[model samples]
Structure formats: C-alpha cells, structure tokens
Target chain A: MKNNYDILVIGGGPAGALAAKTAADAGNSVCLIEKRPAIGTPVRCAEGIGKELLKEFIKPDPRWIAADIERARIISPNGTAISLEQDKAGNEVGYVLDRKIFDRELVWQAAEAGADVIVKTRATAPIMENGAVRGAKVLSVGTPADIRAEVVIAADGTEAQFARRAGLDTVVPLREMMSCAQYLMTDIDIDAGSTDFYLGNEIAPEGYLWVFPKGDRTANVGIGISGRKSRDGSRAKDYLDRFVAKNFPNGKTIEAIAGGVPVCRPLACTVADGLMVAGDAARVVDPITGGGIGNAMLTGRLAAQVASECIAAGNCSKEALMPYDAGWRASKMGTILERNYKVKEYFVTLDDAKLNTLAESIAQSSLKEFSVLALIKELITRNPKMLLELKALRDTLS
Target chain B: MSTMLRINRDKCGYCGTCVAVCPEDALELIDAYLSLERECIACGICARACPLGALEVVHEE
Candidate 1:
C-alpha cells in the first residue's frame, strides 16, 4: 500500500467500496482497506435489498442474487399472516442476496476503477493534525504504516473505531443496539419466493424474527432483539435456538453468524475536517427493519462526491464536508428513517393482544400500496382504540 | 478477590457484537482475534450481548 493518497477509505463493506469506486471514478487517487483478510466473509447481514434500490448502484446479477422475493408475509403472535405481493409491497422487499459474492463484486468494481484495495489492513487510530483528521495509522498485515491522505472516509462498519478516534462520539446506546444471531440452514421447508417475518414479544422482544429464502430449501433464519432485553439465559441466540428447534427441527445449519445493528438515530454530524463517515458507521440503519445496505451505499456515494468536490476546490474542512451530511438528511431515505424510528418506538410498546388485534385488522383489508403510511391509515380506520395514538404519530410527521 | 472478564475463543465468532455494545470501548477485534483493552471495566455488558456465550465475567481470588 502507498503511504499517501488523495483519499483513504477505511473498511471494505458496501460503504467503503462505493466510496472508493466513486472517488476513483472522479479521477482521484483512492485506497480502500479491509481489516478482514477477505472482501466479505462471516457475513453479518441478512443480505436483503429492494430491487430498484439495488439497481441504483449495481445491476442485479444471478451470480449474486440468491432469491427473487415475490411476496412478504408478516405473522403475528396468534399466527395471523398478512401477505403483500411484490407489486404492492413497498421498496423494502425484493431480493435476497448472497453477500459473500456480492461484497467481493463491489470491491472488484472499485479496484477496476483504479482504487488500491488492501486486505488484512486495520486502521488502529486516526492521524490528527491540529484537530483535523489527516489520515489513519494502519497495520497492514502485521506491518504498521502511517497512511496520509487529503481526505479520510470512515466507512468502518458497526465498530466505528476510526470515527471515534477522529473525535466523533460513535457509541451506541444499549437500548438502541439490536443484538442479532443468524444461521444459514438447509433441508428446511420454506416458501422459495416469499420472505417471512414473525412478530411477537415472546419470539423477539422489541424486535422481530425473519426467514429469508436463499434458493432451494435453504434460508437465512435470524432474530434480532433489543440489547436491554438480552440476558444470560435468554439471549438472542437462546431465543433463536428455541424457535429453530420448534419450527425447523430437521434443518441443518451450514453457517452461523452473530453481530449488532444500531437502531438509533444517525450521527448528529457525519463529517469533520478532512474526514467523512458513511454507512453503518453513521448508524443510518432503519430503526424499524434494521436494513442498511441501500442506505450505506447511498451515503458512501454521496460522501465521495462531496469529498471530490472539496478536494477540487482545495478545501477539506468540516464546513466543506457539511454538504454530505445535509444531502442525505434531505433525501427521501432520510425522511423514511425518521418516520420508521417513530413507528418502531410505537410498535415496541404494544403487547401481544394489541399486536394480534392490529394484525387481524390489517389481514382483513387489502392495501393498494404496502407502505408504512397505508398500514397506519388502515389501522386507524379499523381499530378505533388506536386512533388517538396513531393520530399523534401522524401529527409528528407533519 | 477481583472481577474479571473471560473470552472463550473457541465459541467466539469474532463478529464484533461485543465491540459494538461495549460502552467502555474495551473490546477490539483484530481480524479473527478479539482482544480486551485497558479500558475494560468487566461490566459484563459484552458477555450478555455475545450471542455465542463466548464472553464471561468471573470472580477470582
């Protein structure tokens, strides 16, 4: 790896890869580093993305697309299933990806765009100059090196150490952190074209369990619960184990993965002098669904674009990078994130009986468009008891 | 006696869930190896957050 570059991106997830590619495409010298030896291994995500959203960055390829989801089913505590077809389902459901191959493909594209890709390189700390992030102190394959750059993009996933070292408070609140566990199982019966979500306090407190098909009879069975709800004997894994035992007793698990997803608000500030943060590092994951792949890519591309503009103008100060933060918050994704956070807060407060009532109400009605707003409207019309609470939520949005 | 945190490397997936929930910023994952920094207070938050039951807090005399 070089000691100096125009831009340095920490982490090799979708965020860093997109940033590197975007910056390099703008004729800027960029280098991307991954702490792991490979581009994507030990996959931490459920690997689901909206079809149109995926097309915004990269075209969907059969090589990376594991399953083409045609329907989404939400199962309540009382086994009430509310299904939405592909056309009616909002932009959240479309494809179940094979992230192992998908992430590598993104990095490959970044390399093809002339960005230097380095693996097994960990950024231990930020190199700060007069309260400004100059670059990072990285350990590349056991050999420590100080890599300097005009701008540093901190796309380093959930750990977010680089941003914190650069004087950003990247700590997630315990209550907002979603402790998650997932298993890739085969020899299980599943709807090959449908994604299933199980919602109930017993199944996953303040969170939900999902069954996402990955072709054949194999699927990704996962659960995410609030960190505050996690305990020694009743942790996320314990909950998942119980569900799997009862539902897929004969299934064989090929791979198991565990991680944390931040369901809190995004960072108050995503940029500092000579530094920018993107993707999960910025905590832009949807609070309700815990989905972030598209958001990460969006922020990554925007950060690079803004960084390139600042570099061209010979100014990389925090003021110059402020546009990156403002740009995302002004976008549709940002508005949706804010709305979803409120929705999640409201739903988590509901008990099983309330959830069952809402599910039954939703099951009876056919939504023309399966969006959060439509669902809320339906709930208001059917359940008069929830009118006040739902109306208050709607007022906050307006 | 003192309270200490222990990590079972065999069970640990090194997925960084502990690192994320660590309010003290005590846990660091270098590649596949998870390490505890000097900031660790042995609060056991990481232990509870660990999905694999890889982390534990114990009292030793």
Candidate 2:
C-alpha cells in the first residue's frame, strides 16, 4: 500500500498534535491521527500542572482549569513536616487542571492550523525505507497500508515503537522509572489551595504520595515509586489505596487510574533518521515531581518547529535536527527536570534518621541562605559520606 | 451505530501498548504513533500502557 503526506504525525496526544499544528502553521501539509474517537478520555493524569509553565506555551484558559492551588506541604515518614508557607496568594504549587478540556483545546488548535485529524485510527509501524524513516504503515482493516511522510515525529510517549523500529536503542532503567496510580476523589475537607506531599521510605520507598486539591471538595490523590522498588513488592494502586485508606478513609474515590512515569534524564538520543521523539517517550517528566504535562506540551512545540525545519530543508537526519536536542536542554524546563532527577535519586536514598535530621534542621534553620538546595547542603555537612555520593550529582545542578 | 474512540491529540502518547495488548489488533503503532484500524473493537488495553497518561477511549456519542 502506498502512503504519503508532507508530514504524517502519529499519536494525536499533546506532542503529536502540537507537531501537526506547528508544521501546518508553518505551511506544511499535515495529518494528525488518533486511536481514540474522542480527544481526552480515561483520565490517567493527576491534572496538576504548574501555572507558570503553561503560560509559556499558550495562554492559560479557564476552560482547562479545575482548581488553582497556592501552597505545598511535605510530610515525613513519621509525619514531621516542612512547607513553603502559604498566605493564600497562590504562591507554591499552582493549578489542578481539567485534563480533558485542556487536551481538546490543543487538538482544536492543531485542527484550526490545518492539520487533518482522524479518530479511531492507529498507526501500526514505521514504514522503514532505505534505513530512513519515510512514513508509517497503519492497520486499517487487518491490512497494512503505508502513509508516507517526508518526516515522522514520534510523540509516541515512553515505549517508542518508531525509534525502536528505526533501530534506536534508548531504554530508561526500570529503577529510574516510576510506577504511578491515581484516584480522583470527592468530599475531602482539606485546604482547597494547598497541595500535600508525603515522602520517606516508610510511606513510598523510592517515591512520594501527593494530594493535589481540585476544588468542589475533590482531589487528585496519587503515589509513585521507583519501578525496581515497586515492581515485585507492591502494585501502584495497592500502595495508593493503603495510604488513602489510612489517611483519607472518609474521602470518596470518584475514579481510579494507573500508569508509569520516567524520572530519568532525557534519552541519550531523541532523534533518529527521519524521526524525532518527544514527551514521555523521551522521558521528559520532572524527575522529582513525576510531572510531564508542561514538558510534554513544550517538547511537542519544539518537535513541531523542528519537524517544519526538517521539511523545508528536505533533510531529516540527526545532524539537521540537532537544534531540537540542544535547545531543549538549554531550556529552563530541561535544566530543572534533569536537576530534579538528581535530587530525587539523592533524596530517595536518604534513610529515616537522615530524613528526620534534615527536616528538623530545615524547621529550625535561620542562620543564612534559605534555598532548598542550600538546606540539602546543610544536611550533607552533618554527613560527609553523603556529600561524597552527592558531589557528582551536585554537577547535575544547572 | 458504528463506534469510534477519539484521542485528544494533546492528551495522547503514541505508545503502541494499545496495539500490543489489543486482542483485536484494533490498535496499531503507525509512524511510531498509534492509530485505530478497522479491527478496533474499542478495547482499551493500549490506553492502559501509556506512561505519559496520554491515551483515552471515547465512544461515538
């Protein structure tokens, strides 16, 4: 079967649609495909997106907002606490989003930009031709038909079949990935503008649990743990359920969803011949927070801009697409994401005693500089061994 | 009425796990992304595997 397009973008998610919109806006004919018939369904996200980050890509629209949050509180294993004080001005953690509405808006933007979108259609594989990605072969009726594109953007998320088919080997170690499960619950009498985080091995081993309020007495409550730690030990939902049952037993769960997150650095290579990957497939989620919506959208825009460039120049090789790679790392989002991964790795390894000591110190410290990084440095002062291990990671700081 | 699931492109991760675990092969990885072919019975297994929390299943309303 002959397949062809100026640009054939697979996966209509944030990355793919953005790629399509951007390319279309740039005067490239584009096709945006989706396997689902509707735009946003299933509700896998916690819906907590930083307001500041979203403002960078597109205007913040109320249609996509579920709730606005202001403060963040962290709870230790024994419930010891440390928080960024809140006075109700919306300072710390920001919005709890309406993921469904937000996704539709993006796709609509793409369509408005002139990309053709087809729902309930899935691309089966990258149609490899002469070792250069030309397009994809989709299964329309148990029969494979190829759709050719000068360039293919695999906004396909973490399990990248396009790159894999193209023979690009980039795997996030299981230990570096976080398994996540979340519940949208209602009737919880908690602070509407505050988000809570619970850290420490006793509560989450290699990860943490979060309660992000979403107004109307509802909240997105979830937990994630390093894959290696939770793979055989506890299912993500089980961990979340145990915690919720223990803490928010009276809170009624309205919906449940489970998934995984990549907290590692970006893949060693984000582009291959005729293709570029973005979002989760590229492991762009924040290492410490396990958040990716902002990054996914940002990376999607970057990928689209790069794809358009690739089409105009008629070259889609690694050399031509180097700007996407360089620019992404240079972006603040990239810097913070990589830095947080290091912080997460370092923080997860700290024991309860170390945690308690660190929390106590943060609670009482007023001698000088008050950056979170500075406090971590203070904790390391009491434990030189930790300093040695963290020294290499200290370079991980941007 | 024939049914189709819609993926809000903004919310999709083209992970083919939908195709991988789809018994009907309704979901397939195309161009390193996902699309539904004629075989889609609307089983949502592929939506489950996305780590980015991007996949969704919608009915033709």
Best by TM-score: 1
Candidate 2 off by > 4 Å = A1-3, A86-92, A141-143, A231-233, A364-395, B1-61
Candidate 1 recovers what fraction of true contacts?
A: 0.62
Question: Which digits, one per residue and each the tens of the lDDT, describe model 1 over residues A132-210?
Answer: 9998999999999999999999999999989988888888877788999999999999999988999999999999999
In Å, residue A218's CA in model 1 sits off its true spot by: 0.9
DockQ scores of all models, one per candidate: 0.73, 0.07
TM score of chain A per candidate: 0.98, 0.90
TM-score of each: 0.97, 0.81
Model 1 CA deviation exceeding 4 Å by range: A87-92
Give i-RMS (Å) per prediction. Answer: 1.1, 7.8
CA lDDT, candidate 2, residue A192:
83
Tell me the number of clashing residue pairs for each predicted model.
0, 34
lDDT by residue (tens digit), candidate 2, A173-271? 556657677888899877788788888776776888898888868889988776555532364666787888888889998877655676778878777
Q: Report how closely model 2 matches the true complex, as a DockQ value.
A: 0.07
